[model samples]
Target: MTHKIAILGASGYTGAELVRLIATHPEMEIVALAAERKAGMEMRDVFPHLRHLDLPTLVKIGEIDFSTVDLCFCALPHKTSQEVISALPADLKIVDLSADFRLRDPEAYETWYGNPHSAIEMQKEAVYGLTEFYRDQIKNARLVAGTGCNAATGQFALRPLIEADVIDLDEIIMDLKCGVSGAGRALKENLLHAELAEGYHAYAVGGTHRHLGEFDQEFSAIAGREVKIQFTPHLLPTNRGILATCYVKGDAQVIHKAFENAYADEPFIELLPLGQAPSTKHIRGSNFCHIGVVADRIEGRTIVVAALDNLTKGSSGQALQNANLMLGVEETTGLMLAPLFP
Candidate 1:
């Protein structure tokens, strides 16, 4: 069964990525493309890299007939996503890539996003789209909220340890480095080639980054208590990938065993051998996440490293994975491509 799909915000990086991946998907077909600003233009005109394929010309969100779309991937900006998704057909399944529906509490959403959620009722029903942890829920969900790239990477490193009680909760600290693509395709003075190249710097220091809300909500729920970890993210000069180095107090071997056990049956997650580490280069442009663990010289302290393309496993690839489940197709159908290596 070919599931008809529409991609809103078709001009953005994630939108183009969805097009690229779905173009090869066996059970999914892109039927419509929407971009408010790029309306009436072909997707290839906006992203020449996609010029090879034939796709519907971009249109305004309101112009598309959602009744015909089996599922929609909303890659729009946060506030915009809520308004657009709220107005979408009630029965239409959705996978939202924005931060709009990620936090369950409206107040928490306001506190982090600085705006009260405009679609509270819809937010309540949106399943968190962390596919590995919420597979069953995603399969049945009418709406799924994709996690922040950084949040997803961090959780992959720590969630298993937290669930197994193998790590010290209070001492957990994650220092992550992300490529500029995670910031989105929007233009920023800081993201310019001259300004960002040949350098790397940290932002959202001192627990100020918005993704902390997701980390707080998810980790707290898992541990059955308030779990706050020191999280600081750095902006790298590259165009893809995320490398998260996590520090936890635990036995290295035990933590390694815990991850191996948790992800043993999972397809996209790769747990490396003990004392080894993964690099962003290995998983670039792929829907795979590589995790590795190493013991610190100090007893009872361990280090965990995780890597993936911020735009793939971190966003579009994840959306497609969930869409597969929702459509009753194999979860790994379109996501089996190998990581691009140099």
Candidate 2:
């Protein structure tokens, strides 16, 4: 019953996370690990913490035998993901952890990513990979596109509100803070230990963050009209998790009730009591999302906060969740790992 899996871009943080999660999975096994630049190297040498697990040496994407891979997790960077995925076996099951296929419209993809999408046909067929809401779609999908960690965090806070019309959609504002690991393992001047240790600054201000494409697509589709949210993201000094605080015009108690009704049966979504909020530490290294609601002094204002590990629930864990569904396994199988508490 073991599903043979291949991980492209295995040297990256998300890719390594896939390896860590699969190492213990009863129904899935890592058969090939691909890293373009790190090809010909041992996976354990690329990620020391994973030295205990015996894994295949890193190879280039071109070197993987897709016919033997039950599913492939693409953790490559943006433009590269589309080019590589387009060249992959068209019938291969793929769970993409990149931004390439998340946006449906080729024009929208180019607008946000600054390049024309090279795989529009596949983009049209890829299902959005928010496991809680897209369960049915993912179970039948050959390709699933993982959402932005920030986008996933914010949506977990607000989607129910919008669906039930409990909040004023036009006044929605999401102020999110993300761990440095969400930036990926790429070398950057701002990500240097010296530069990031005490630094907390907002980037992609004024709706420039590409995840807006997701927020707009999902929210608008649900509301049956154009819905735009004010979203601003900040960089945290830490290495994991995302905290998204949403400010909205709504009846506080009713919105809390909405979350209760929406996630009452969802395995990974946790609803905290009124006046409480979640911390990123509580959900780190796990596929759980904790949401809390607080009422503002103003009669019609409510603040909803959500927390999850950027590397787990936000990306790689999400990919694995979709893969399980695609493989006809239980939705929560191989993903019941407890959150790492400090």
Which candidate ranks first by lDDT, i.e. highest? 1
Worst 10-residue lDDT window, candidate 1: 78-87
lDDT at position 273, candidate 2: 99
TM-score of decoy 1? 0.99
TM-score of each: 0.99, 0.99
Error of 2 at 14 (Å): 0.2
- Candidate 1, residue 61: the lDDT equals 89
Prediction RMSDs, each to the true structure: 0.6, 0.7
For candidate 2, what is the lDDT?
Answer: 0.94
The ten-residue window of minimal lDDT in model 2 covers 327-336
